[model samples]
Target: MRAVFVRPGGGGVEVRDVDVPEIGEGEILVRMRVCGIDGTDLEKAFGRPITPPMLGHEVAGEVVESKTSEFRPGDRVFVHHHVFCGRCYYCLHGSYTMCPLFLKTTIEPCGLAEYFRVPRTNVERGAVLKLPDNVGWEEAAFIEPSACVLRAINRAGFRPGDSVSIVGVGPTGAIFIRLLKSFGASVVAAADLSSFRLEAARRLGADIVVNPLEADFPEECRGATDGRGVDIGVLATPTVKPLQTVLDTIRKGGVLLIFGAPEKGEKAEIDFSKLFLRETNIVTSYSTSEVETNLMLSLIASGRVSLRDLITHRFRLEEAEEAFQTARDAGRSLKVVVEA
Candidate 1:
């Protein structure tokens, strides 16, 4: 088998031959169809590492071997990378992602491989689902990311007719735009340095788009909302500057959803007085739970949302380096996929 490995010391990805993982008693081996490249994969390839050896996570495939009665060979599916123990306190409190068990398990090797294993713990807890017949590999590949975006929107208390300013129009921001519109958000303006991403946001239904280089993003977002500011501001990229500047782009008492995860100890100072006086609330989201994954799959199955358009680049397993390079330059690509 061949898998993409993140080279040590912040270099890039490498495709190497490796022995296929042996499935455990209750596990299933999945034959990869397509795997979606996320920002974290690029981070692992060129920046600091988040997960070990493994990188990619957005996976969709067919069951090649099943040891449990719940699945059979040739069954098409979308496998979640994380599964939480529903019996835990964190799970009981609706913070499923915070459950300790959720963080400990993952597919063997990585999602960016010819094949991988789904553990029994994940299967017993319902972390796997059969892809609908109409859903293509690209759409199934969206299950994880869409589930993540759904979690953020739900936690942020988003409502119909609310206006939102999305800072950093990358793949994640594009998902936010599409979902916010479906949720009935009225004004959706995106701010980014990349014209390629901005155009992608426009296609995804962003009502207005602005480049931070050409204009004041905060001011432009405020202008679209009668000078009061948008109801919500999303810092999608979590760049040091945007972390400090997005606060000025929303209305008093509005919400700021930090969807991007910054590296450990990466700090940015903010105006405490302004934050307190305005009653600005900061909310964050991490990972996806089975709750949103089910809904996301349905959304794609029903054709309520289309993901094929978001995937602008595709590569084979051997083209890992080129794929990571294109993903690094946001000016050229949106969603990059690696096929089996």
Candidate 2:
């Protein structure tokens, strides 16, 4: 088996031969077809701690072997890396991601490998989704990420005809724009440093595109919204350095949703006085659950949202290094996929 291994402390990525993992009872082995690469994979590769160490997780593949009768060899599927134990206290309380079982389950050897094992815990907990014949492999690869964005949209209290300002217009931001448009958001403003991303957002339905490097983002949002700012401001970038700018772009009673993920120990200096004076609320949505995954799969299978639009680059499994680097380069790519 061939897999891409990331060494800790920025050691670099290694594409080498390793033993193909043997699945235990009730487990399934997936022969990778394609996998999506995002910032989290980059973090794991360049030396941050991401558990199950081998690292890729937005996977779409075919079943090579399965211990369970429900699935068979040759079945195409999407492996949900995290699964929760329904009987647990966290599950009962609706904190599915917080369940200890959910935090620990993952595909063996990781999604970057040519083949990986799906644990029994994952399969039994609805982590394994069999793809319909109508769904293509590349589109199936998007189930995990789209599920994540769907969860965030649900938590955002988003409504039809509402106004919005997105702080970052990367691949995830594009997904937000597409879904927001479906909900009939009248004003969709996107802010970014990249003209390519901003343009992409526009094609997806952003009415106003602002480059903070060239003009004031808050002022742009206000101008777009008749000086009331936006109804909801989304901080889609990974750093909080833009926290104040995003906060200032929202109406006093609006919500500022932090959707981008930051590294460990990353801190933001926010003014308590300002926050107290304004009634703006801050919220965040973490990893998705089986519930959200079901919806995402249906949305794709039904052709309501096309993940294919986000696919800007594709590389062979052997070109793993270049693929990772391309995904890291914001000026060049949207969604980068590694195909086996």
lDDT of 1 at 295: 94
Name the top lDDT candidate: 1
User: For candidate 1, what is the TM-score?
Assistant: 0.97
Local distance difference test scores for all models:
0.87, 0.85
Q: Write one digit per residue (lDDT tens) for candidate 2, span 17-108.
A: 98999999999999999999876777677644434465788998999998998899999999989998888898999888778887788888
lDDT of 2 at 286: 75
Q: What is the lDDT of residue 173 in candidate 1?
A: 87
lDDT of 1 by residue, 96-180 (tens): 9999998797888889999999999988888899997899998888889989999999899999999999898778888899889
TM-score of each: 0.97, 0.96
- The reply for model 1, stretches above 4 Å from the true place, is 50-53
